[model samples]
Target chain A: MKGLDLNITIVGLGLIGGSYALALKELQPKKLYAVDKDEEAIKVGEEMGIIDKGFISPEIPLKESDLIIICIYPKDIKDFVKNNIDNFKLGSVITDVTGIKREFAEEINAGLRKDIDFVFGHPMAGREFTGVKYASKEIFKGANYIITPTERNKEESIKLIEDIAIGLGCKNVEKVTVEKHDEIIGFTSQLPHVIAVSLVNSDNLGVDVGKFTGDSYRDLTRIARINTKLWTELFMGNRENLINQIEEFEKNITDVKTALINKDMKSLSEILSKASKKREEMS
Target chain B: MKGLDLNITIVGLGLIGGSYALALKELQPKKLYAVDKDEEAIKVGEEMGIIDKGFISPEIPLKESDLIIICIYPKDIKDFVKNNIDNFKLGSVITDVTGIKREFAEEINAGLRKDIDFVFGHPMAGREFTGVKYASKEIFKGANYIITPTERNKEESIKLIEDIAIGLGCKNVEKVTVEKHDEIIGFTSQLPHVIAVSLVNSDNLGVDVGKFTGDSYRDLTRIARINTKLWTELFMGNRENLINQIEEFEKNITDVKTALINKDMKSLSEILSKASKKREEMS
Candidate 1:
C-alpha cells in the first residue's frame, strides 16, 4: 500500500460490476473494494478472488479510493450518488456502467460535492443473463464505451474515466454531450426494442411462429423476450426521444402505406431499394 | 425422350426454379424444359445439366408438359396463366413457387381450360441471392410448403401438386384455404418485414451500425435488406390484410406510448412481459 498508485472500488456486483472487477483484477489495483446490497454477490466476488475485500454498506473507508465505479439499476443511480459522493476522497473520479447517460449524468453532477469528481460512461455490452456468476471481463473486449461529459467536468477527471474505459478493453471510447447520447441511443437501441415489442404484440398469431417462421419473423422478433423491469425504466427514462424516433419510423411506414394503397409500384420499389441499399452500406 | 413417363417444364428458371430442377434431376424426368428471358440462365441450366432443354420463351411446348412450374414475380402470374394455361395437355397440372396465393389462385382457376388444372402452392424457402445459379434443392430440405387450395382445385389436381412439393424435400406440407393463408402470412411473415424496413428507415443511422449493434439492432434488421420488387408485389397482393396487421401493431405501439407518457410502469411492464412470454411460447 506504500507506493501503489490506484485504489479502485466497485459498487453493486451484478453482471456489469463483477465484469468490471474481473477486468480491473488484471490491472492489479492496490485494493479492490466490492459493495452490494446482496451479500451473496460480495461473497462470490471475494470467493472468486476478484475483490481484495467486500463491504455491505457505503459508510466504509471510501475516501481512500482513487476511483469508484457504480453498476446498479438506473433507478438507484441518484440516491447512491447522493449518499456516497461525500464518502469519496476529494478530486477522485467516479464513473458508471449505466446504459443511459443524460439525466443520470446531470443529476449526479448537480448533487455531488464539487470537489468529488463524477464522470459518466456507458459500456455498451451485455448478456441475456445477469448476476455475478454470469459476469466475464471478455464482454468489454470489442464493446463500445461512450462518455457523456458536461461543461462542469474537469479535463483531468474526464481523462481518468476515459483511461479506465480504454484499459477495460473497450474498442471505441468516445465523448458526446448528454443530449446527443440519449438521441443517438434512442434511434439505434431503444426504438429497436420498442419496435420488436410492438411487432410481437401485433397479434396472437394462431400458427406456432416457431415451427413455420422464415428468416423474417424469427429474426425481427429475436429481441422480443426482454427484461421488462429494466427496460421499463430505460424506456421511461428516455421516452421523449424514443417517441420522437417512433414518429420518424411512423412517417416511413406511412409512405409505405400510401404506396401500397395507391398500388404505386414505382414509389414502393424506390423506398425498398433505398432501404436495402442503405442496409448494405451499413454493413 | 421416347416412351418416358414424366415430362416436366419449369417456367422462369430463377433461384427457386433452378433449385427445383436440381432436385427433380434425381427423379430422372424424361424431359426438363427451362424457360427464362435471360438466355444466359437457360444456358447455365443446360451447361450445369440441370435442364434437358432450354427455351428463351414460354411459347414452346406448354402442351407437352405434364407439369409446368412458374417461378416468376407475382405480378406476372395472372398474365402468364391467361396466355398459356390452355396449352397445357388435358388433365395435366401446373403449379408455382409464388409466395402469395388467394387472388392468383382465383384468377387462374377462373381463366383455365376446365380439362387442365393450375394448382397454387407456395414453397416456403429462399436465399438472398437470385437466379438459377443460386438455386439449391437443399433449401427445401427442412422447409415448410403451404398448399393453399381454392374451391376450384380438383382433389386429384391438388394431390398431384402436393406430391411434387413433398418430392422436392419439404418437411411439412400443410393445407389451408386461400383466405387463411393470406391472414396467417399477414401476421407471421409480412408484418415482420414491414417492421424491419420501418426501423431501418427510422433515421439515417449515421453510425457504422455493424460496428456497435448488439443483438437487438443486428438481429432485428437482418431482413431489412429484402428483395424490393418481389416484396412490393407480395405486399400489394395482400395489402388489405397487411394493413390490418399494421393497424394491430399501431395499436400496440400506442399502448406503449401511453404507458411511457403516463410513467405507468405497471402497464409498460405488463406489455413487455406478455410479449416476452408470447415469444417464448411461440418458440
Candidate 2:
C-alpha cells in the first residue's frame, strides 16, 4: 500500500483537507505539502507532522508530485486553480472536494491548462464541526466518495483519485455525471440544511424554549449549527438546484397543509403512511 | 414517595398511559386501574404488575378514584369523558395527557359535572412506536411535563398533577396557558412532524436513495416513520396553529430562497449566522 512515491499537495487545511493529509500519510507519499491561508493551520500541521512542507499562500512553490487535491470553498476554487495551475507539471491530475460540480467542472475546464486532468468529485462525509482541530480520518469510515469525471478525465487519473478515496477508508466510490451529482446532492444535502436553518429560525424563539424541546426538535435542528460563510457560498453556487428542491419540498408540505385544513383524513393518512413505508425501507 | 394511598385510574392503556402507570407505581397508589379498549393491553398491564386492575372499556365502573388520567387520542376524548363523567364521584381531579388542549379544555369543562375538576396537561415525551408493549417509566426521564390549567381547576388538583409529574421522574414541570401551549407545540412538535413526512415523501424517492443519505438526512426524517391515524387526528385538532406555523416556516424558508436567488450573500450569511447562534444556545 505504501509503494506509491508520488508527491501530494493538499490545498486548504480545513476539515476535509486535514483529514486527507492524515489518511494519505498511510500511503507514504514521497512528499506531502500542506497549503492554507491561515498561519496557525500550517504551524499546527507542521507540529503534528502531517506535512513535510507548509505554505501559507497558494502562490508558493508548487513543484511536487503530479497529484493535487483542492479543498477550498466554492467561490475561491476557480481563481485559486487558475492562478496555481502552473505549479504542477504537464500531465498532472487535479481534483477538488466541492459540493457543487457542474459549474466548477465547466469553469475549471475553461481555464485549466490543456495537459492537466481535472475531475470534480465530492466526498459525501462531513461533521457538524469545522476546522483542522476537529478533522479526523475516522469521519471517512463507511462514507461514500463520488467522482464526477468530465470527458477530459483520463482513466489513470480517475484510478488515482479512487485509490486515494479507498485509502482514506471510504466505503464506496461511485462515478456519476456532473449533472446527476448536483441533482442528487441538491436533494440530500443542500435541501436538508436549508430546512434546518429555516426550522431553527422559524420562530421568534426565547431561551426558555430549551425546557420544552423534545427529541424531535433536537434532532431536526442538529445541523442548524452551521458555518455561515462556507454554506452561503455553496448555496449560491448550487442555487438553481437547491431552489428547485425547496420548491418541491414546499409543494409537498402544502399538499399536506391543504389536506389537514380540509380535514381530509384519507389524504393525510395516505401521505403519512407512504412516507412511513418509504422511511422504513430506507432505514 | 410510596406513602400516599391515593386511588388512581389511568384511562387508555397506550404508550403514554402505560408509561404513566409504571411511573406512578413509584408513588404506591393504593389502587391502580388501567383502562383500555384493547383486552390485550389490559392483560399485559396486569401481568406486568403495572396495574392492580384493568378495564376493557370506559363503560365499566370507575369507583372512587382521587385522580383520573386520560391518555386517549384527540377525537375520541370528548366522547369518552362525556360518556363516563357519571362514573367518577364528585371532586375527582380529571387530567388528560392529550397533546392539544384549547378545544378539549373547553369541551371537557362544559360537559363535566360542576364538582368535577379538569386540568388539561401535556407530557412532552413520546416514542416512535406505540402501545403498552413499548411503554416504560424511563420515557419520563429528562422529559418536561406541562399543565394547562383552566380557571376552574382547583389549586389542590394542580398540585396533585404536579406531584405525579415529579413522581414520574419528569425533569421539569411547567405551567402554560392552553393558547400558549397550542402555539408552542405547533412549532416544536407538529411543524417538525409535518416537515419530516413531507421530506420523506417529497419525491418518488427510489429505494436506492439510501446510499446518498447523510446524518442530516437521517436526523431530519427520523419521525417520518409515523402512525398515520393518530397523527392525522392530532394534526386536525391543532389545525389552526399548525397551519399558521407551516406558513411561518414557509415564509422563513422563502426569505432564504430569495436571498439565494438574488445572490445576496450578506443577507444569506446573516440569516444562517443568527440561526447557528440560536441553535448553539439551545444545544
Candidate 3:
C-alpha cells in the first residue's frame, strides 16, 4: 500500500482505463490486469503493451489486485459493481472514473462487502478524441482529480485514491460530496461540452464560410466531437443538474436575443462585459 | 507604388491599426502616419515605434496622406469617413478595417468625393488581448485579409488595396460583397465571442475551478476577454445577421437539451458525430 508494489486491476480498457493503465505501469505495479467486454479493445491494449495482462470478461481479478478501478460508462457501473461485489478482497479499495456519481455511490456502498472500501474518483481530463488509441499518461499532467465520497467511505480509502491520483501526476486534488461534485461538473464540464455540440450543429454555413472561421469557432466546437453515447448517459444520470445548467444558459441567450432585436448595442455590450468579467474572475 | 515607397496613413492607432502600421513598416514605407482621436493611444504608438508620427488632429495628416486606413468601431465609420472625405487628394484610395460592412460601405460611398475611391477591407485575425502594446507585426503572417466591395467601388482601387495586403504578407486575400461579408463575420467572429462570453459568465465557481478548467473551456472562452464597447457597436451595425446567428444557436441548444432529457445516447452521439463532421468540413 505504501508504493507501486501494490497489485492493480483496471476495468473497461477504453480511453480512461487505458490511460490509467499506462500511468499505473509507470509506477511499476507488482501485477497489472485489465478486463473489458470488447475483445478487440483488450487485444489492442495487449498489443500496445498498455496493460500487463488483460481479459475479455466481467470477472474481477480479485485475489491478485490490491486496487480495482472502474472506467465504464455510467449505465454500466451498477451492473459491473453488482457482478463483482463478491469478488473484492477484504482491505482492498475500489474507485471509478465515471462522470456521474450520487446514484453509483449509493448503489455501490449499499451492495459492497462492508470490509472492502469504495472511494469514488473522477479525473477532469479527456479529449474530443476517444478510445484506447487516444489514451495517454500525459493527459493527467495538468488535470484535476476529484475524489467524491459519502459518509460510508473510510478516510483511509479516500487517502489511498488521492495518493494514486498524485502518483499519476495530477496537478490538483480536491474532496467534495457526490452531489456537490455533480453540480460543479454540470456547470463547468458537462454544460460546456453540451454548448459546444449545439453550437457546432447549428451552423448552416457552407464549408467555405467555415474555412473562414477563426480560432473561436473552432475552440467552441472542440468538444462537439465527443463520444455522445457515453456523454448522453452521463447527462441523463445527472438529469436535473444538466437541465438546470441548460435552463440558465437559455435565459442568458434570451437576454442576448432581446438586445439584438432591440438594436440595443449598449445593453448587449453590458451583458458581454458582465460575462467577460465573470469568466475572468473564474480564470 | 510599385514597391514600398508609398506613404500609408493608419487612422486609429489601436490593435488592428497599430498592427497594420507595424506590418507596413516592415515593407518599409516611405512614411507612416498615425491618426487617432485618442491622443494617449497615438503617444503609445509613437513610443512603441508602431507609428512614425502621431497626430492629435486629422486635418494636417489627412491632406498629405496617400492611403488612409480607418480602424475605428463600426458605428464610428460613417462620421470618420465624412470628416475626412474632403481631405483625400484626387484619385487617392481609402479603405477600412471594420468588422461589419454593408451600412458602412453605403454610408462611406455616398459621402466620398467624386474623385476619390473607397474599398472596404477586413482582416480576420486577432487575439483576446487588445491595444497597440500587444499588437505584433507577425499577426498578419498566415492570416486572412478580406476585401469587401460594392458596385460603386472602382476596380483600380480594389487592385490597389489587394496589392497593399499582398505586400503586407497576408496569406489569403479574399474579395466578398459587403452584405455577405457581414453575415460571415456575424457567425465566425461575433457568434464565437458571444458564446465565449456566455460560457465564461455562466459558471458560479470562481478561481479554484478555473484553475482546474482544461484547454476545452479555455479555448471556448478565449475571446471572452473582449473589447466590449467595440463589440457592442459591431453587433448594432449588423443586427440582422447577429440576431439570426443567436436564434440559430438557441435552436441548436434546445435540440441538445431535448436529446439529454430523452436519454437517447445514440442520437446524442449521432448529433455530436454530425457536428464533428460538419466542423471538419469547415476547415
Candidate ranking (lDDT, best to worst) = 2, 1, 3
**Shift in Å, residue A79, candidate 1:** 2.9
Instruction: List DockQ for all candidates.
Output: 0.47, 0.58, 0.57
Model 3: residues with Cα > 4 Å off, grouped in runs: A1-3, A24-28, A37-51, A57-62, B1-5, B59-64, B163-171, B204-212, B262-270
The TM-score of candidate 1's chain A against the true chain A comes to 0.90
lDDT of 3: 0.80
Which one is best on DockQ?
A: 2
Judged by DockQ cut-offs, is candidate 2 incorrect, acceptable, medium or high? medium
Best candidate (score: lDDT): 2
Interface RMSD of 1: 1.9
lDDT of 3 by residue, B1-283 (tens): 3457667788888888888988888777777898888888998998897788989788777787778888877777788778777777667778888888888788778877887778889877777777788888877776678898778778878988888887777777889888888888898888878777777666765437774566677777778888888888887888889889989988888887887778776777777778777766655
Q: With candidate 3 superimposed using the best TM-score fit, by how many Å does residue A181's alpha carbon deviate from the native? A: 1.8
lDDT of each: 0.80, 0.85, 0.80
Q: Point to the candidate with the largest TM-score.
A: 3
Candidate 3 docks with a DockQ of: 0.57
